[model samples]
Target: MTKDIHLYTASTMNGWKPVIFLEEAGVEYDLTHIDFAKKQHKHPEYLQLNPNGRIPTIVDRSNNDFVVFESGAILWYLAEKYQKFLPQKPDERSVTLQWLMFQMGGIGPMMGQAMYFQRIAAKQGEENLFATDRYVQESRRLMEVLNARLAKSRFLACGEYTIADMATYPWARAFYWAKVQVEDLQHLNRWFDEIDARKATQRALTIPKPFWAFFGKGNVEVQERENADRFKSDVISRSNI
Candidate 1:
Protein backbone atom coordinates (compact mmCIF):
# COMPACT_ATOMS: atom_id res chain seq x y z
CA MET A 1 0.00 0.00 0.00
CA THR A 2 1.19 3.49 -0.82
CA LYS A 3 1.35 6.08 1.88
CA ASP A 4 -0.11 9.57 1.54
CA ILE A 5 2.21 12.53 2.03
CA HIS A 6 0.85 15.98 2.71
CA LEU A 7 3.18 18.70 1.41
CA TYR A 8 2.76 22.33 2.41
CA THR A 9 4.66 24.69 0.15
CA ALA A 10 4.68 28.01 -1.61
CA SER A 11 5.86 28.41 -5.22
CA THR A 12 9.27 29.75 -4.27
CA MET A 13 12.46 27.88 -5.19
CA ASN A 14 12.84 26.17 -1.84
CA GLY A 15 9.19 25.17 -1.89
CA TRP A 16 9.45 23.74 -5.40
CA LYS A 17 12.43 21.53 -4.52
CA PRO A 18 10.46 18.87 -2.66
CA VAL A 19 7.51 19.10 -5.02
CA ILE A 20 9.79 18.32 -7.95
CA PHE A 21 11.47 15.53 -5.98
CA LEU A 22 8.17 13.94 -5.02
CA GLU A 23 7.03 13.99 -8.62
CA GLU A 24 10.33 12.71 -9.95
CA ALA A 25 10.43 9.90 -7.42
CA GLY A 26 6.84 8.99 -8.31
CA VAL A 27 5.79 9.40 -4.73
CA GLU A 28 2.12 9.81 -3.91
CA TYR A 29 1.61 13.13 -2.18
CA ASP A 30 -0.99 15.86 -1.75
CA LEU A 31 0.11 19.50 -2.11
CA THR A 32 -1.17 22.41 -0.06
CA HIS A 33 -0.10 25.92 -1.07
CA ILE A 34 0.84 28.09 1.86
CA ASP A 35 -0.12 31.60 0.83
CA PHE A 36 2.67 34.00 1.67
CA ALA A 37 0.39 37.00 1.10
CA LYS A 38 -1.69 36.44 4.21
CA LYS A 39 1.32 35.15 6.08
CA GLN A 40 -0.19 31.67 6.29
CA HIS A 41 3.21 30.23 7.03
CA LYS A 42 3.28 32.14 10.33
CA HIS A 43 -0.21 31.14 11.40
CA PRO A 44 -0.76 29.34 14.67
CA GLU A 45 -1.80 26.10 12.95
CA TYR A 46 1.26 26.01 10.72
CA LEU A 47 3.58 26.90 13.62
CA GLN A 48 2.30 23.80 15.39
CA LEU A 49 3.46 21.73 12.43
CA ASN A 50 6.74 23.64 11.91
CA PRO A 51 8.04 25.90 14.62
CA ASN A 52 10.13 27.76 12.09
CA GLY A 53 6.98 28.94 10.30
CA ARG A 54 8.24 28.01 6.91
CA ILE A 55 6.85 26.31 3.83
CA PRO A 56 7.78 22.91 2.34
CA THR A 57 6.76 21.06 5.47
CA ILE A 58 5.43 17.51 5.14
CA VAL A 59 3.30 15.12 7.11
CA ASP A 60 3.20 11.38 6.64
CA ARG A 61 -0.40 10.34 6.46
CA SER A 62 0.40 6.66 6.64
CA ASN A 63 1.84 6.64 10.12
CA ASN A 64 -0.27 9.67 11.02
CA ASP A 65 2.69 10.76 13.07
CA PHE A 66 5.66 11.67 10.96
CA VAL A 67 6.39 15.35 10.25
CA VAL A 68 9.32 16.95 8.52
CA PHE A 69 10.55 20.41 7.46
CA GLU A 70 13.43 22.02 5.55
CA SER A 71 13.99 21.12 1.91
CA GLY A 72 17.29 19.30 2.56
CA ALA A 73 15.83 17.31 5.42
CA ILE A 74 12.77 16.49 3.34
CA LEU A 75 14.98 15.20 0.53
CA TRP A 76 16.98 13.10 2.99
CA TYR A 77 13.80 11.68 4.54
CA LEU A 78 12.20 10.76 1.23
CA ALA A 79 15.39 9.18 -0.04
CA GLU A 80 15.98 7.14 3.13
CA LYS A 81 12.37 6.09 3.65
CA TYR A 82 11.67 5.22 0.04
CA GLN A 83 15.20 4.00 -0.68
CA LYS A 84 15.06 5.65 -4.08
CA PHE A 85 16.93 8.51 -5.78
CA LEU A 86 19.76 8.16 -3.28
CA PRO A 87 23.06 6.37 -3.72
CA GLN A 88 23.76 3.31 -1.56
CA LYS A 89 27.54 3.67 -1.61
CA PRO A 90 28.72 5.56 1.44
CA ASP A 91 31.23 7.78 -0.37
CA GLU A 92 28.78 8.84 -3.10
CA ARG A 93 26.18 9.50 -0.42
CA SER A 94 28.62 11.73 1.41
CA VAL A 95 29.39 13.64 -1.78
CA THR A 96 25.70 14.12 -2.41
CA LEU A 97 25.31 15.56 1.08
CA GLN A 98 28.21 17.93 0.35
CA TRP A 99 26.59 19.43 -2.75
CA LEU A 100 23.24 19.72 -1.03
CA MET A 101 24.88 21.58 1.84
CA PHE A 102 26.65 23.82 -0.67
CA GLN A 103 23.34 24.79 -2.19
CA MET A 104 21.72 25.45 1.20
CA GLY A 105 24.63 27.32 2.69
CA GLY A 106 26.13 29.10 -0.29
CA ILE A 107 23.89 29.49 -3.33
CA GLY A 108 20.45 29.86 -1.78
CA PRO A 109 21.24 32.55 0.77
CA MET A 110 23.39 34.65 -1.55
CA MET A 111 20.85 34.59 -4.35
CA GLY A 112 18.12 35.41 -1.87
CA GLN A 113 20.00 38.53 -0.80
CA ALA A 114 20.65 39.45 -4.41
CA MET A 115 16.94 39.29 -5.11
CA TYR A 116 16.19 41.37 -2.04
CA PHE A 117 18.53 44.20 -2.96
CA GLN A 118 17.59 44.20 -6.63
CA ARG A 119 13.86 43.98 -6.10
CA ILE A 120 12.78 44.95 -2.59
CA ALA A 121 15.24 46.99 -0.57
CA ALA A 122 13.66 50.30 0.46
CA LYS A 123 16.86 52.32 0.60
CA GLN A 124 18.44 50.20 -2.09
CA GLY A 125 19.43 53.29 -4.04
CA GLU A 126 21.48 54.41 -1.07
CA GLU A 127 22.96 50.93 -0.50
CA ASN A 128 26.56 50.26 -1.36
CA LEU A 129 27.11 48.93 -4.85
CA PHE A 130 29.85 46.80 -3.34
CA ALA A 131 27.33 44.89 -1.24
CA THR A 132 25.17 44.18 -4.27
CA ASP A 133 28.18 43.15 -6.30
CA ARG A 134 29.39 41.01 -3.44
CA TYR A 135 26.28 38.82 -3.48
CA VAL A 136 26.11 38.72 -7.27
CA GLN A 137 29.76 37.74 -7.48
CA GLU A 138 29.36 35.06 -4.79
CA SER A 139 26.32 33.62 -6.58
CA ARG A 140 28.23 33.60 -9.84
CA ARG A 141 31.23 31.90 -8.22
CA LEU A 142 28.98 29.19 -6.78
CA MET A 143 27.49 28.66 -10.21
CA GLU A 144 31.02 28.33 -11.55
CA VAL A 145 31.76 25.68 -8.94
CA LEU A 146 28.64 23.82 -9.97
CA ASN A 147 29.52 24.21 -13.63
CA ALA A 148 33.01 22.82 -13.13
CA ARG A 149 31.61 19.94 -11.07
CA LEU A 150 29.01 19.18 -13.71
CA ALA A 151 31.63 19.21 -16.49
CA LYS A 152 33.41 16.30 -14.82
CA SER A 153 30.23 14.46 -13.82
CA ARG A 154 26.74 14.35 -15.23
CA PHE A 155 25.22 15.34 -11.90
CA LEU A 156 26.39 17.22 -8.84
CA ALA A 157 27.35 13.91 -7.23
CA CYS A 158 27.66 10.22 -8.19
CA GLY A 159 27.44 11.01 -11.92
CA GLU A 160 23.69 10.29 -11.82
CA TYR A 161 20.58 12.28 -11.06
CA THR A 162 19.83 11.91 -7.37
CA ILE A 163 18.50 13.87 -4.41
CA ALA A 164 21.49 16.18 -4.75
CA ASP A 165 20.31 17.19 -8.19
CA MET A 166 16.80 17.70 -6.83
CA ALA A 167 18.13 19.85 -4.02
CA THR A 168 20.19 22.21 -6.17
CA TYR A 169 18.12 22.45 -9.35
CA PRO A 170 15.44 24.78 -8.03
CA TRP A 171 17.85 27.45 -6.75
CA ALA A 172 20.02 27.27 -9.84
CA ARG A 173 16.90 27.53 -11.95
CA ALA A 174 15.98 30.64 -9.99
CA PHE A 175 18.90 32.51 -11.54
CA TYR A 176 17.25 32.08 -14.92
CA TRP A 177 13.71 32.67 -13.67
CA ALA A 178 14.89 35.88 -12.02
CA LYS A 179 16.48 36.88 -15.34
CA VAL A 180 19.96 36.85 -13.90
CA GLN A 181 22.62 36.43 -16.57
CA VAL A 182 24.51 33.10 -16.41
CA GLU A 183 25.79 32.85 -19.97
CA ASP A 184 29.37 32.32 -18.84
CA LEU A 185 28.51 29.31 -16.70
CA GLN A 186 28.13 26.99 -19.67
CA HIS A 187 28.17 23.67 -17.86
CA LEU A 188 25.70 24.85 -15.24
CA ASN A 189 23.56 26.20 -18.07
CA ARG A 190 23.59 22.78 -19.71
CA TRP A 191 22.62 21.03 -16.51
CA PHE A 192 19.88 23.59 -15.92
CA ASP A 193 18.55 22.98 -19.41
CA GLU A 194 18.63 19.23 -18.83
CA ILE A 195 16.63 19.54 -15.61
CA ASP A 196 14.24 21.99 -17.27
CA ALA A 197 13.55 19.37 -19.94
CA ARG A 198 12.34 16.84 -17.40
CA LYS A 199 8.59 16.16 -17.36
CA ALA A 200 8.56 16.20 -13.57
CA THR A 201 10.20 19.64 -13.43
CA GLN A 202 7.71 20.97 -15.95
CA ARG A 203 4.85 19.62 -13.88
CA ALA A 204 6.26 21.03 -10.66
CA LEU A 205 6.43 24.49 -12.23
CA THR A 206 2.68 24.52 -12.71
CA ILE A 207 1.68 23.10 -9.36
CA PRO A 208 -0.51 25.43 -7.23
CA LYS A 209 -0.63 28.04 -9.94
CA PRO A 210 -3.93 29.28 -8.68
CA PHE A 211 -2.38 29.86 -5.29
CA TRP A 212 0.39 31.89 -6.84
CA ALA A 213 -2.00 33.78 -9.08
CA PHE A 214 -3.51 35.45 -6.03
CA PHE A 215 -0.28 37.44 -5.69
CA GLY A 216 -0.43 38.46 -9.37
CA LYS A 217 1.31 37.13 -12.48
CA GLY A 218 4.47 36.37 -10.50
CA ASN A 219 4.68 36.54 -6.75
CA VAL A 220 8.03 38.33 -6.80
CA GLU A 221 6.60 41.80 -7.35
CA VAL A 222 3.81 41.28 -4.90
CA GLN A 223 6.19 39.94 -2.31
CA GLU A 224 8.48 42.93 -2.71
CA ARG A 225 5.63 45.37 -2.20
CA GLU A 226 4.42 43.54 0.87
CA ASN A 227 7.87 43.36 2.35
CA ALA A 228 8.53 47.01 1.71
CA ASP A 229 5.27 47.98 3.37
CA ARG A 230 6.04 45.79 6.35
CA PHE A 231 9.48 47.30 6.73
CA LYS A 232 8.14 50.82 6.53
CA SER A 233 5.53 50.07 9.16
CA ASP A 234 8.14 48.56 11.42
CA VAL A 235 10.36 51.61 11.10
CA ILE A 236 7.48 53.88 12.04
CA SER A 237 6.53 51.74 15.02
CA ARG A 238 10.06 51.51 16.31
CA SER A 239 11.06 55.17 15.94
CA ASN A 240 9.34 57.99 17.84
CA ILE A 241 10.61 60.39 15.16
Candidate 2:
Protein backbone atom coordinates (compact mmCIF):
# COMPACT_ATOMS: atom_id res chain seq x y z
CA MET A 1 0.00 0.00 0.00
CA THR A 2 1.10 3.57 -0.59
CA LYS A 3 2.46 5.39 2.44
CA ASP A 4 0.19 8.45 2.35
CA ILE A 5 -0.06 9.33 6.01
CA HIS A 6 2.83 11.46 7.18
CA LEU A 7 3.50 11.22 10.90
CA TYR A 8 5.80 13.74 12.52
CA THR A 9 6.57 12.45 15.95
CA ALA A 10 9.11 11.56 18.59
CA SER A 11 9.17 8.62 21.01
CA THR A 12 6.82 9.97 23.65
CA MET A 13 3.72 8.28 25.06
CA ASN A 14 1.34 10.54 23.11
CA GLY A 15 3.34 10.01 19.94
CA TRP A 16 2.97 6.25 20.23
CA LYS A 17 -0.83 6.33 20.57
CA PRO A 18 -1.71 6.95 16.95
CA VAL A 19 1.18 4.91 15.65
CA ILE A 20 -0.17 1.92 17.51
CA PHE A 21 -3.56 2.53 15.96
CA LEU A 22 -2.00 2.82 12.52
CA GLU A 23 -0.01 -0.34 12.94
CA GLU A 24 -2.97 -2.29 14.27
CA ALA A 25 -5.04 -1.08 11.34
CA GLY A 26 -2.31 -2.23 8.92
CA VAL A 27 -2.00 1.21 7.37
CA GLU A 28 1.13 2.32 5.54
CA TYR A 29 2.56 5.65 6.60
CA ASP A 30 5.75 7.67 6.33
CA LEU A 31 7.41 9.10 9.43
CA THR A 32 9.21 12.39 10.10
CA HIS A 33 11.22 12.65 13.27
CA ILE A 34 10.40 15.86 15.10
CA ASP A 35 13.57 16.66 17.00
CA PHE A 36 12.82 18.55 20.18
CA ALA A 37 16.50 19.24 20.87
CA LYS A 38 16.85 20.92 17.47
CA LYS A 39 13.59 22.88 17.95
CA GLN A 40 12.33 21.60 14.61
CA HIS A 41 8.76 21.53 15.84
CA LYS A 42 8.82 25.28 16.46
CA HIS A 43 9.71 26.14 12.86
CA PRO A 44 7.18 28.21 10.92
CA GLU A 45 6.73 25.41 8.39
CA TYR A 46 5.91 22.87 11.05
CA LEU A 47 3.74 25.42 12.84
CA GLN A 48 1.50 25.48 9.75
CA LEU A 49 0.85 21.77 10.20
CA ASN A 50 0.32 22.05 13.93
CA PRO A 51 -0.30 25.44 15.55
CA ASN A 52 0.48 23.93 18.92
CA GLY A 53 3.92 22.94 17.51
CA ARG A 54 3.79 19.62 19.25
CA ILE A 55 5.03 16.19 18.35
CA PRO A 56 2.81 13.49 16.76
CA THR A 57 1.17 15.62 14.08
CA ILE A 58 -0.16 13.80 11.03
CA VAL A 59 -0.68 14.93 7.47
CA ASP A 60 -3.06 12.74 5.53
CA ARG A 61 -1.92 13.21 1.98
CA SER A 62 -4.64 10.83 0.85
CA ASN A 63 -7.22 13.17 2.38
CA ASN A 64 -6.20 16.39 0.62
CA ASP A 65 -3.14 16.63 2.85
CA PHE A 66 -5.35 17.04 5.86
CA VAL A 67 -3.65 17.65 9.19
CA VAL A 68 -4.55 16.30 12.60
CA PHE A 69 -2.98 17.39 15.87
CA GLU A 70 -3.52 16.27 19.43
CA SER A 71 -2.94 12.57 20.07
CA GLY A 72 -6.53 11.75 21.03
CA ALA A 73 -7.83 13.53 17.95
CA ILE A 74 -5.43 11.58 15.77
CA LEU A 75 -6.64 8.29 17.21
CA TRP A 76 -10.26 9.28 16.71
CA TYR A 77 -9.58 10.38 13.16
CA LEU A 78 -7.86 7.15 12.24
CA ALA A 79 -10.52 5.02 13.92
CA GLU A 80 -13.26 6.84 12.09
CA LYS A 81 -11.52 6.82 8.72
CA TYR A 82 -10.73 3.12 8.94
CA GLN A 83 -13.98 2.14 10.73
CA LYS A 84 -12.07 0.03 13.20
CA PHE A 85 -11.33 0.15 16.92
CA LEU A 86 -14.22 2.54 17.48
CA PRO A 87 -17.67 0.98 17.52
CA GLN A 88 -20.39 1.94 15.03
CA LYS A 89 -23.17 1.79 17.61
CA PRO A 90 -24.00 5.12 19.27
CA ASP A 91 -23.95 3.87 22.86
CA GLU A 92 -20.77 1.81 22.46
CA ARG A 93 -19.09 4.61 20.53
CA SER A 94 -19.98 7.14 23.19
CA VAL A 95 -18.57 4.89 25.90
CA THR A 96 -15.37 4.45 23.94
CA LEU A 97 -15.08 8.21 23.53
CA GLN A 98 -15.73 8.70 27.22
CA TRP A 99 -12.75 6.50 28.16
CA LEU A 100 -10.69 8.17 25.50
CA MET A 101 -11.58 11.52 27.05
CA PHE A 102 -10.71 10.13 30.45
CA GLN A 103 -7.23 9.39 29.27
CA MET A 104 -6.90 12.72 27.50
CA GLY A 105 -8.23 14.89 30.34
CA GLY A 106 -7.10 12.78 33.24
CA ILE A 107 -4.44 10.09 32.79
CA GLY A 108 -2.16 11.87 30.30
CA PRO A 109 -1.97 15.22 32.08
CA MET A 110 -1.77 13.87 35.62
CA MET A 111 0.90 11.31 34.80
CA GLY A 112 2.81 13.88 32.71
CA GLN A 113 2.79 16.23 35.67
CA ALA A 114 3.79 13.41 37.97
CA MET A 115 6.72 12.61 35.69
CA TYR A 116 7.84 16.24 35.62
CA PHE A 117 7.60 16.77 39.36
CA GLN A 118 9.04 13.39 40.34
CA ARG A 119 11.89 13.15 37.85
CA ILE A 120 12.70 16.37 36.01
CA ALA A 121 11.90 18.90 38.74
CA ALA A 122 14.35 17.48 41.26
CA LYS A 123 17.03 17.29 38.59
CA GLN A 124 16.54 20.99 37.85
CA GLY A 125 16.86 21.88 41.53
CA GLU A 126 13.28 23.16 41.50
CA GLU A 127 11.77 20.26 43.35
CA ASN A 128 8.45 20.83 45.06
CA LEU A 129 7.43 17.95 47.25
CA PHE A 130 3.92 19.33 47.38
CA ALA A 131 3.52 19.30 43.60
CA THR A 132 5.19 15.92 43.30
CA ASP A 133 3.01 14.41 45.98
CA ARG A 134 -0.12 15.96 44.62
CA TYR A 135 0.33 14.68 41.06
CA VAL A 136 1.48 11.27 42.21
CA GLN A 137 -1.55 10.97 44.46
CA GLU A 138 -3.87 12.06 41.68
CA SER A 139 -2.24 9.68 39.24
CA ARG A 140 -2.76 6.84 41.69
CA ARG A 141 -6.39 7.76 42.06
CA LEU A 142 -6.83 7.78 38.30
CA MET A 143 -5.18 4.38 38.09
CA GLU A 144 -7.66 3.11 40.64
CA VAL A 145 -10.51 4.42 38.51
CA LEU A 146 -9.11 2.58 35.52
CA ASN A 147 -8.61 -0.52 37.60
CA ALA A 148 -12.19 -0.41 38.76
CA ARG A 149 -13.41 -0.12 35.19
CA LEU A 150 -11.14 -2.89 33.95
CA ALA A 151 -12.27 -5.13 36.79
CA LYS A 152 -15.67 -5.36 35.15
CA SER A 153 -15.03 -4.72 31.47
CA ARG A 154 -12.75 -6.79 29.29
CA PHE A 155 -11.43 -3.55 27.84
CA LEU A 156 -11.85 0.14 28.60
CA ALA A 157 -14.84 0.64 26.28
CA CYS A 158 -16.42 -2.72 25.63
CA GLY A 159 -15.73 -6.41 25.16
CA GLU A 160 -13.39 -5.69 22.29
CA TYR A 161 -10.32 -3.48 22.44
CA THR A 162 -10.89 0.01 21.09
CA ILE A 163 -9.14 3.36 20.54
CA ALA A 164 -9.60 4.13 24.20
CA ASP A 165 -7.29 1.25 25.09
CA MET A 166 -4.82 2.40 22.47
CA ALA A 167 -4.83 5.92 23.87
CA THR A 168 -4.42 4.94 27.51
CA TYR A 169 -2.04 1.96 27.37
CA PRO A 170 1.12 3.89 26.50
CA TRP A 171 0.71 6.22 29.46
CA ALA A 172 -0.21 3.42 31.85
CA ARG A 173 2.81 1.37 30.79
CA ALA A 174 5.06 4.27 31.80
CA PHE A 175 3.57 4.53 35.27
CA TYR A 176 6.92 3.91 36.93
CA TRP A 177 8.42 6.90 35.14
CA ALA A 178 5.67 8.96 36.73
CA LYS A 179 6.45 7.50 40.18
CA VAL A 180 3.09 5.72 40.39
CA GLN A 181 2.94 2.10 41.43
CA VAL A 182 0.71 -0.52 39.77
CA GLU A 183 1.62 -3.79 41.44
CA ASP A 184 -1.33 -3.50 43.76
CA LEU A 185 -3.80 -2.79 40.97
CA GLN A 186 -4.43 -6.28 39.64
CA HIS A 187 -7.05 -5.28 37.11
CA LEU A 188 -4.94 -2.44 35.78
CA ASN A 189 -1.90 -4.69 35.51
CA ARG A 190 -3.96 -7.31 33.69
CA TRP A 191 -5.20 -4.73 31.24
CA PHE A 192 -1.74 -3.25 30.71
CA ASP A 193 -0.04 -6.61 30.21
CA GLU A 194 -2.58 -7.72 27.63
CA ILE A 195 -2.07 -4.56 25.62
CA ASP A 196 1.68 -4.68 26.05
CA ALA A 197 1.71 -8.19 24.63
CA ARG A 198 0.26 -7.07 21.31
CA LYS A 199 2.62 -7.21 18.32
CA ALA A 200 1.51 -3.85 16.94
CA THR A 201 2.13 -2.08 20.19
CA GLN A 202 5.64 -3.49 20.40
CA ARG A 203 6.34 -2.37 16.85
CA ALA A 204 4.84 1.11 17.27
CA LEU A 205 6.94 1.83 20.36
CA THR A 206 10.13 1.87 18.28
CA ILE A 207 8.95 4.42 15.73
CA PRO A 208 11.71 7.10 15.50
CA LYS A 209 13.41 4.81 18.03
CA PRO A 210 13.06 5.14 21.80
CA PHE A 211 15.38 7.35 23.86
CA TRP A 212 17.29 4.50 25.48
CA ALA A 213 18.16 3.04 22.07
CA PHE A 214 20.78 5.78 21.64
CA PHE A 215 22.58 4.85 24.84
CA GLY A 216 23.39 1.23 23.85
CA LYS A 217 26.14 0.40 26.38
CA GLY A 218 26.16 3.70 28.23
CA ASN A 219 25.48 3.99 31.97
CA VAL A 220 21.78 3.43 32.73
CA GLU A 221 21.54 6.38 35.11
CA VAL A 222 23.18 8.70 32.58
CA GLN A 223 20.72 7.58 29.91
CA GLU A 224 17.73 8.06 32.22
CA ARG A 225 18.91 11.52 33.29
CA GLU A 226 19.39 12.54 29.68
CA ASN A 227 15.91 11.27 28.80
CA ALA A 228 14.38 13.12 31.74
CA ASP A 229 16.26 16.29 30.75
CA ARG A 230 14.92 16.06 27.21
CA PHE A 231 11.40 15.61 28.59
CA LYS A 232 11.85 18.76 30.68
CA SER A 233 13.16 20.80 27.78
CA ASP A 234 10.54 19.60 25.31
CA VAL A 235 7.37 19.54 27.46
CA ILE A 236 7.82 21.11 30.90
CA SER A 237 9.43 24.26 29.55
CA ARG A 238 6.53 24.79 27.15
CA SER A 239 3.44 24.08 29.27
CA ASN A 240 2.37 24.85 32.84
CA ILE A 241 2.07 21.16 33.67
Q: Which candidate achieves the best lDDT against the true structure?
A: 2
State the lDDT of candidate 2 residue by residue for 1-241, as single tens digits: 6677999998888988888998999998899998877889899999999999887899998899999999999999999888999999999999999999999999999998987776676776677899899999999999999999999999999999999999998888888678788899999989977986899878888888764322133364786687667766644554565
RMSD of each: 3.8, 3.2
lDDT of each: 0.77, 0.86
lDDT of 1 by residue, 27-49 (tens): 88887888866789989999999
Candidate that scores best on TM-score: 2
Which pairs clash (backbone N, Cα, C closer than 3 Å) in model 1? Answer: none
lDDT of 2 at 175: 80
Residue 119 miss distance in model 2 (angstroms) = 1.6
TM-score of 2: 0.92
